[model samples]
Target: MAGGLGSKKVDITWSTEESGLLMAISVKTINFKDGKTRNYQKNLTNRRGDLLMEAVTLHRRFPYSVLAAFFFLDAGAENDGTPKRRSTFLNAHARLKLFTDRSDPAGREEQFERFYLILLEASPNSVSVRPFKVGDPDNEVSLSQMLDEILELVAERNPDFYEFDDGRLIKL
Candidate 1:
């Protein structure tokens, strides 16, 4: 995608809630003649509250460029010297159950679809998604990856939920 004619490649570097995860995304938008590049958005936090939601919006024009938007949670910056806390036992259990559920395919599918679409709506040219990987629950995960995992797990639990290939959400 890089070093190509009429290829719009964007590179961005941003952090996640936990100190361990950050994002470096490169998206290529193929236009008619030329392309553009820019950093979209990034979040840095310690996993104490809701993570920031990063999105991109494209301008309405030929060879349109994109802009990144960061949606912060009620909690502020991760390095704001705030003490870290753990989620309640029920909250943790509920999340796990939702991910592991295999019976309610419709519900899981709906939840997953909504989650990813929200991200897509926020982003300008989100042609693909990357799942987040964390060694531990306390570890920070990339916002992109976190959303990706939810999409994957939902599809795994219920094949009919969505039609995505290789992290790229497709119309199937």
Candidate 2:
């Protein structure tokens, strides 16, 4: 949907549960803080893509265990600090799988963990967090920067495993 001149369509992607890597990570950008949600579905969906790319790249270098970390982060299964949905943003949901590498057992577990850790670290300031409050200190921290840091940490710890965007993960 376009709002006016120079406007752009909301980006989106599709995925499923049987994919066996990760699911979705929707990210929403609303005008004001509490206005209606537009492209809320796209937010999580694209974020999922970011995570899937990270895990697949890593699978070549690291063990399944390591890759799993990123996979789960994308899928949204490891929820802890995630935003609590209000009636306003509830209908804006979108779905996307983490990755479709559901062929191996070890590989699946690695993906799960990958999804888990990324969410654990990135939740506080995530786009999802916007529904709750407004201004804050940590909110200023860029999500892309955070993703990059996490990717670097993963690469540095497991040098023999995985590749990311310049050692950076794209934040949703």
Candidate 3:
């Protein structure tokens, strides 16, 4: 219902009377190419911008909601007829780190909560989720860990609402 800061829509969101806006998520995917690093980075930044504005508006109403981004980066490309370029995985990660550098400082004072970038690799037969998180470069954890963090964040505001244990979401 709100529009601005390029936030035509929020990718994912949740609400409850107790927590108000609760959570808002932005999802972006990058299929890495050689020299299109800047372009891909710009695309992600644009999505991030959208998430920020939406979060701000929601937070103004709820005051306890949080914004998050889940970025999916393709580490390998199938023979999808696209031109092959030397991958800039490190550069891509750095650009995302820049995204956090801009957001995290304000996150503490605002509604932003967490960032999850899942690096995916495919071999035309199998794909896997190697999850990464912002705020800590050395942090590496499973998808369950990621969900647990979300639970913790929400728990901070809705302490009596739910519990997350061993990947199970328990409602109270």
Model 1 C-alpha lDDT per residue in residues 66-125, reported as the tens digit of each score: 122222221211112213533222122233232222233233221111121111112365
TM-scores of the models, in the given order?
Answer: 0.25, 0.28, 0.66
Residues 1-172 of candidate 3: C-alpha lDDT, one tens digit per residue: 3432323466777876655566667777776543644333435556555555655665555555656677776744222222453233444445445444222323433335777667778788998877777545346679877777776666555657866566665778
Best by TM-score: 3
lDDT of candidate 2 over 13-130, digit per residue (tens): 2222323222222233322221244222334445555544554444433332223222112213222122654221222221323343233534542242322222222445563421
Model 1: CA > 4 A from native:
1-137, 157-161
TM-score of 2: 0.28
lDDT of 3 at 109: 30
Backbone clash numbers for all candidates listed:
8, 30, 0
Is candidate 1 or 3 superior in TM-score? 3
What are the lDDT scores of the predictions, listed in order? 0.27, 0.32, 0.57
The TM-score obtained by model 1 is 0.25
lDDT of 2: 0.32
